[model samples]
Target: MSHHTVSVELENKPGALVRISQLFARRGYNIQSLAVGPTERPGISRLTLRVDCSEHTIEQIEKQMHKLVNVLRVVELLPDESVERELALITVGAPPDRRAELIALGDVFGARVADIGREALTFEIVGRPEELDAFEELVRPHGVRELARTGRIGLRRPGPRQSRAQAALT
Candidate 1:
């Protein structure tokens, strides 16, 4: 099954997340990644979910989400129409001799040194999911002490709109 990213708008209230999670469980759809946060509008939250399912199953899931009380909106984030990102904090063993090496590696991957301990260096990386994965692999040989990844969060891209004049020109 391929992966699909779904964006949901939920009411910012207690038990809202529970209801959604229960629905997924009941449907036997495993969530690969989920991120939830408040939106610009008060009393509303946005939930981004990554699930592995077929097109038919995803459609059914979306329909079920629409019937839920807390869910206000449900939309599949098509890759071409959305921008996605994930954040990772990786703590790798860094001996004094290897500190400069790791730092240079971080520079190539756009990661920053979040913390610099004598034996460990915590690097902060923010990028697309694949980019994060590549960084993780590159640093694994250094002996990772800990790693934390904030699952993907995404928003639809606002492409160029055709105003009246633009439409006329086109």
Candidate 2:
């Protein structure tokens, strides 16, 4: 199975998200990551979803999504031509003796110390999924007390901005 990232634009109305999830459920497709937020345009929301499935399955999902009333557009964010990111917050048990060492490691990963307590240190990191994984590994030995990751969100590289006349010609 191949991993695919799908971007969807839908009306920001009640039950719109539920209906989309229901479509995936009925088809037995598992959503790996999902992010939904308001776009620059009001009354609309952009959804970024990551799924592991074959090419044919993704095509079928998109077609079914098109049949739904709320969905406006759906597009795939190809890895080669898109930028993807995820954010993670990690709280690690830090003894007084180990605080300095942990902070140093976090600096190496471009993580900032979000919070510091006598016994725990909370770090915030934003990067590609793999980078987050590496940071986790680096802190695992120190005892991770809590962790949260905002799943993959992505956008395609800007190809070009077309003027109204250019769009009409195309």
Candidate 3:
């Protein structure tokens, strides 16, 4: 039941996302987080999916994704070898007297004050899932008004050997 992140490159066409989601639904796999966007290649899109499953299940899921018509490539992003990020927007109760304290707390987490209403302050935070969770926990006592979090997005980092080889070629 460990979390796994899978990155898929696919055709940027209508219903592509729906089809991928259906595949997971049919297999009874719940997606923990999913993010899809256009890639540098104009006609292709990259999808980052986070799911809780065993190693065997993830292998099967990758194989199934490869068989889909729209999917071009599928790869598992290992935590130690990949860079992952998530964005969250949180609005908390902020009275005039507590504004500075809230702002200081946000600064500790590298969050920005997106808005400062009279009774509420909105913060924009971008970081790993755990970082966002910690920020939320600390701000909960301030009375969270609303919160929205984007799915995790990840990119695999090149290994040392690959980097060395590429450098030599350059």
- What TM-score does each of the candidates earn? 0.93, 0.90, 0.92
After superposing candidate 1 on the true structure, give the runs of residues whose Cα lies further than 4 Å from its correct spot.
Answer: 160-170
Model 3, which residues run further than 4 Å from truth? 160-170
Question: How well is each residue in 34-115 modelled by candidate 2, as lDDT tens digits?
Answer: 9999898999999999999999999998999998899999998877667788999999999899999999999998999999
RMSD per candidate (Å) reads 4.9, 6.2, 4.3
Cα error, candidate 3, residue 133 (Å): 0.9
| Models ranked on TM-score | 1, 3, 2
lDDT of 3 by residue, 120-169 (tens): 99999999888999999999999999999988888877663345554443
Judging by lDDT against the true structure, name the best candidate. Answer: 1
Question: Candidate 1's C-alpha lDDT?
Answer: 0.93
Backbone clashes in model 3, listed as residue pairs = none
Q: Estimate the overall C-alpha local distance difference test score of candidate 2.
A: 0.91
Each model's total of backbone clashes: 0, 0, 0
